[model samples]
Target: MSELAVPGIAYGGDYNPEQWPEEVWAEDVRLMREAGVTMVSVNIFAWALLEPREGEYDFSRLDRILALLHENGIAADLATPTAAPPAWFFRAHPDALPVDRDGRGLSYGSRQTFCPSSPAYREAALRITGELAARYADHPAVVMWHIHNEYGCHNAECYCEASAEAFRGWLREKYADDLEALNRAWGTTFWSQWYYDWDEIIPPRATGAVPNPAHQLDWRRFCSDELLSLYKAEREVLRAAAPSVPATTNFMVMYNFDALDYWRWAPELDIVSNDHYLQSTDPESEIDIALSGDLVRSLAGGRPWLLMEHSTGAVNWQPVNRAKTAGELRRNALAHVARGADGIAYFQWRAAKAGAEQWHSAMLPHAGTDSQIWRDVVQLGADLRALAEVRGSTGTAKVAIVWDWNAWWSVELPSQPSGEVRFQDLVRAWYEPLWRAGVAVDFVRPDADLSAYRVVLAPSLYLVDDEGAANLAGFAERGGTLAVGFHSGAVDENCHVRLGGYPGAFREALGVRSDELFPLLPGEPVGLSEGGTASVWSERVRLDGAEAVTSFASGPLTGVPAVTRHTHGTGTTWYVATLPAPSTLADLLDRIRTEAGVTPVRVTPEGVEAVLRRGEDADYLFLINHGDRSAEVEVPAGAADLLAGKPVEGGTVTVRAGDVVVVREPR
Candidate 1:
């Protein structure tokens, strides 16, 4: 992949000069230079300002803004600003507004209020995008083109008349206009819901009882593709107009925003970028940064990607906006780079004085240059400059986790066996163990090539198709260590139960057969014979050809197999029937990883993260200490501490509490 057109790591944040007075533009640029800023996204939500009236366009303010940025030597990531249509658009076409699941009509004013499938919205969006492209195609300030704001944030799925028609069209193409095939795929015979005509099928909307699971799943897929089509339409227009500049939209790929299937969306994007914010509720929110960055980089196929938006301190949306501590901001930024980001950016350059996100933190906060936030921003800019060589470097992972949006969507549908089958929780539970074990792992598509990985983990994978199952079995057969978690392989692509037994797909490979699942209560954890407790889940399993490594010590099905191991074609498969305690799970995972001959990038003490990114000349090692005490980090002989600008005296660099150090070791 071609990197962003910048000398080093791309810096700066979203610049919304239109929100401020023209007189302030000079001061903003002066401060940007002070912070060593390089690039910024402009006009992200400026549709109303750019297109004031129907078919009327204004580029005067944007032109001046670009000229000022160019004079200051700051690159621009010009946005099309199609995410928010003007109020006049809603007035002209009220049907463009998205409808809630309850069939309630939504009003304008909020961002992303327009439905994705609306023809009027798409046409108007593409027109503005084309105009912007034609104007700034050759502008010296422009380096990249940002297509839209975050997709599917406010209106993930709409239940309007137009959306229903669009959904019908999408389904027709999917089933090749075969009504019987559609019925068989949807399994609509249970409630006499067979569709004789194409028009009879509508989105699964506002039903009294739980709607057909298959219909709901297809609706989710259709909604995602609908927005993707919109993005592609806009991308085509931009491609023809600004053929050189790369185009991308901000993706919210965290556990909180799991609407789009990024595996499908990654191919459409010229640059894989995302907007990530620390969840206020989680005490250990830094892990979210690592997870989100790895996910983005995997979507980029191990190429470096961009951190489109993050907050300097507190974000305005959470229930309680807690500000970052003194050194927390810098640690957060560098962690993203350690995972795979080549660029670091924020939500806004200067804090807004008015509007919805007035209180959101920024590079230039409302306190101006006299505050700690401003000082930290300046220091971070220098830190990035010092470690610029890490850009375009690729990180390697020996372990891969299977994650699919279809499985996530299907596993959480209503009327499940247990309420604790949360998709995000499952991923985090399995991922945190690997994180603490200091090994790098990549999240792969369900049907992706798994031969490169030494270890593969599928946790709570409740839904899978034949090809995906075969891929997993083939990986195990090729001498890879495979770990299967509870509730996996229960259903196929059509959401129909893989009958005969639970975990139907992998039963042959795992050598275990289970007919019933004993879902434990929230607080009623069952005891394991291996001196630990397993919570939330416990399955009754009988060994077919596998060996029972452990059993349930106390539960409904006492003495039942709790964990089993089977050898299938020279490789081993371990099936865990319950969510074990973290320590036990970590110990088990480490044992299996060691058996498979997979080692960490560099083993370090607790709270100190070690990740290696290999470049053309050298391998860069990022050591981040999340603890309070100082940490002595050992590097290879002749390694230099890039941050300290000195060679290691005794192959050791003492990283202070709440600090980051990057070591450069020759390959």
Candidate 2:
């Protein structure tokens, strides 16, 4: 907690020395050194090697790996190899096998296949983690404790008696032993699914009651809690043995594994880390990554986070995996650092030869360290190590965007007019303009204090759970302009739709009632004029106390409110009825900036994305060229691009594609 101290941008990744021979291990060490890898994450998937049978363990291979890493002047992030249960353990306790939607117990082959709520699995996992923690907790080479990897990918719940009983207990605690209350919360009246007893409720599966959303929603919440309990148990063991070592697991971003609520998990983590992978070639890719980075940072409350698992090149599992361009990896890495990352680590180090991810990118590809990919890795490492301090140093951002998981969960869980409403899309729309404007931003959930910002943007915001609507109202009442978008506040925390009307709980604050929703079909446009279109879901609303700021035209909702505004205590709440094109969003941002008395942090000459990260007396200005052509950016005539150690003259600094120019302005 004392300012997370890693030597530098901790590099190196899931290293499995046990996977190869001694000679190959030696070669890997040499290659890692060349790649500027100072930190090695070892023993990620070595459970099979560590313990081949029940009540039996071996630590020699891991000892050698840790020792070799230390001997080479590299740090080791020791993993408690519980990611994959040993075949012996799974064989010994067949109950450890996961139960699928069809009630079939899963066979052990892939990793992340153990049920979190299974007592047998928990006992075995605890024993292994406890043993490992006790054995290596004090080793000088060990820097952090990594619990199970990607903790919640397995199917949720087991129809086995153990899980059924556990679910009953959970139900009793949550609903006070009242079946009626439980039935009401789950809205069990639908489909004649009313529960007579706690035993009547079963884990919702894809096969049965597919249309029963309430039951499915509860299942999601239950799954999230179950996995969280698993993580807590592992952390408990690690904390007892290695109290000083920060413990965490890598979180997959926007993942459907409902059990891992990052917001709830963030505080428990010594350092919040996330894995993000995308296959898009669009300009919005950077914006998406930036939003995710900010989300992690906000979870850490502005503390630096770790880019736990990014690929060096193409990912193998995506439907259409594309290799990163020459400079794309570097650009993405720096983008995270610029936002607020303390470290960067990839999913793998050595290439797998016979697994599902065999073709996934690695630090040492199948071609070895002599390949072009290896050269890129080495160059990137050299650059990071060269500018180590600046890369790790914290940056301050004035503007913030709120990201809430509860709202996301409860909002989309409900059956709305159109199943096409995506909360992630709305969030992206609000964030892209701020990113393009070079506005330094942080992501806060609705409950987070909004007193610091001149403008707060909450897009989609469908549920407004966790005091979000009130906070937005408070921010506006306190003279802060808030821009909220479609489906803002329609449900409560219980997944119950707000009683009054759509935007139910927030209608009074926003001064509008959503009367009708119009779904835009493919190839159809909700005209914003000037050739811009909102081509997804459109809404028709009438303003009560709010004034119509923008209107839809040439569509079913034409002349209705596309955007509306209401005067709150001292500021305003603007509601956008549909997802607008970037130009319209930018225009809205311009209006907000003017009304909120805010200005662009700094303007670049052209072709560069300029961002300012302010510290007390030192302001870090990042001028990155995301465009194909070289960009000339204006700086204070004599201010230096600190990372390059070159001074700017006549306020001009030119940067090439994927190039980053870091300028430090001293007060």
Candidate 3:
């Protein structure tokens, strides 16, 4: 934002000057400026270097780094370095070490080994935060306050005795100190387990049998809240010291993370940011980038968010690290900007010569400036400078998808109907069709307001509260199209099954009820009456007031409804009783969207990704080609290609393979 003093899209990555010699510091700055870098994250994981011993401070190294950055015209995304504490603190306060579910206390060797519930850890972290704020709040190169590194990457929860005590305290507050209320919420009567006293409860630690679903659910909620409290505490100290500086922590809101409830966490930050790394082995990984970017944009309430971290080439963590092809790097980076990234950054500027991530790709690779990664880095820098006017552009869409952390946790808990029912996979199944059709969509909590949406899909919403059900029903009642994913509406907020039938909470609105679920084994494909195969799941459905659009053809539930449509009020709702083949589902989604009257300004063909970001004066159109063949996009009238700095010829342009075309059109 303008408040952060970044003139355009901020570039650069994590800079660990402490990791290298003094001779390398100057060279890094020179390389940074040469790459058109404006900002770099500094001091992350430097706690050991900053405060070598407890109560002893040494700012000499960080002082030189910041001074060097300022001299080179590079602003600093200054991190507080609380994510990793020094070895001396860990040795002195071993009680702060986190314990796993089976009760093995983690030793201090890697980063983020400290528990969030440890008071000793909290006090020490805040003390360092306050000291950093008091000293460098007014520094010339400081632009934004990066409060901590990825918060829940390593130690999101701890099952130690202190954490158990903290859990009890959190429960007391949640239930207002009423032990009986806690029992009702946790549904402890099934196992003859009733909590007469607060001390009897603990995080659902290792047990011989299945643990309580509601207990596990609450533990997840508490863990997320505990970490949020730590961030808030540090943020308050930072604000008290320097209120003008915006504060944020990078959220790993992609595949490797499902720890924090970002719905509750997004509003706490001055600006929302996220770290998105492509899963190396996923052939359709670009779709994941779109999903991640849309989610971060939604988390920021449709405002442009920072692309906090990504890899320039192969990342070190995957099974087999594969290098990006010739045009793959810019495709990944610019794709984020197309969705709603105001700034783009990578994880590290220079690949390390030593450490766990020495093989991780960076802007300046180990092979030096002669490598392709460096050449691509130089080209991307020039490209970013050319598209500087695209800042402050915001993305909006009428379609919304429900993404809930609580439901995801409970749906994947032990003792469910099927272990193959993945929440993330189901969501992608629903979203990929829309993404391929070039329809922009935002993610919302189930209970969030849906008045702005014309269509909403809740995929595998196995656990929903009454409030969320009412909200979804109300959206359909008010003339919004709704798609109820298979296996959804079966359970309430407390993990209690809604007993009327399957798809219980939505039975009335959907006007259909399933008698039973038939979860298929791998390679088992049940035929649908609509000339396609349904796999992974199938259900015996009975229509109440709905029309059967398709029926099961080969299962024991043959002649039963496979899919149904019901008209509720002025709106319509569709119930999917099984996971349909990709082509069949895409066709169904297109039909629903057409009936809902949801249309883009122009249709994007099969291989192109079309997105619009509206600024005060113009609407920027991004057409990215992810297919083998070239994609032809009809350029909007009076539009200019921002990338090439020229007008479109013949009112159209062909996007070559893996290339991004940004067109600027007046609003």
Query: lDDT per prediction?
Result: 0.90, 0.75, 0.90
Task: Write model 1 residue lDDT over 214-238, tens digit each, in one string.
Answer: 9999999999999999899989988
Residue-by-residue lDDT tens digits, candidate 2, 105-147: 7788888777767888888888999889889989888888888
TM-score for every candidate vs. truth?
0.99, 0.94, 0.98
lDDT of 3: 0.90
Give the clash count for model 2: 1
Decoy 2 TM-score against native: 0.94
Q: State candidate 3's TM-score.
A: 0.98
Look at candidate 3 and give me any clashing residue pairs. Answer: none
- Candidate 2 residue pairs in clash (backbone atoms < 3 Å): 224-259
RMSD of each: 0.9, 2.4, 1.2
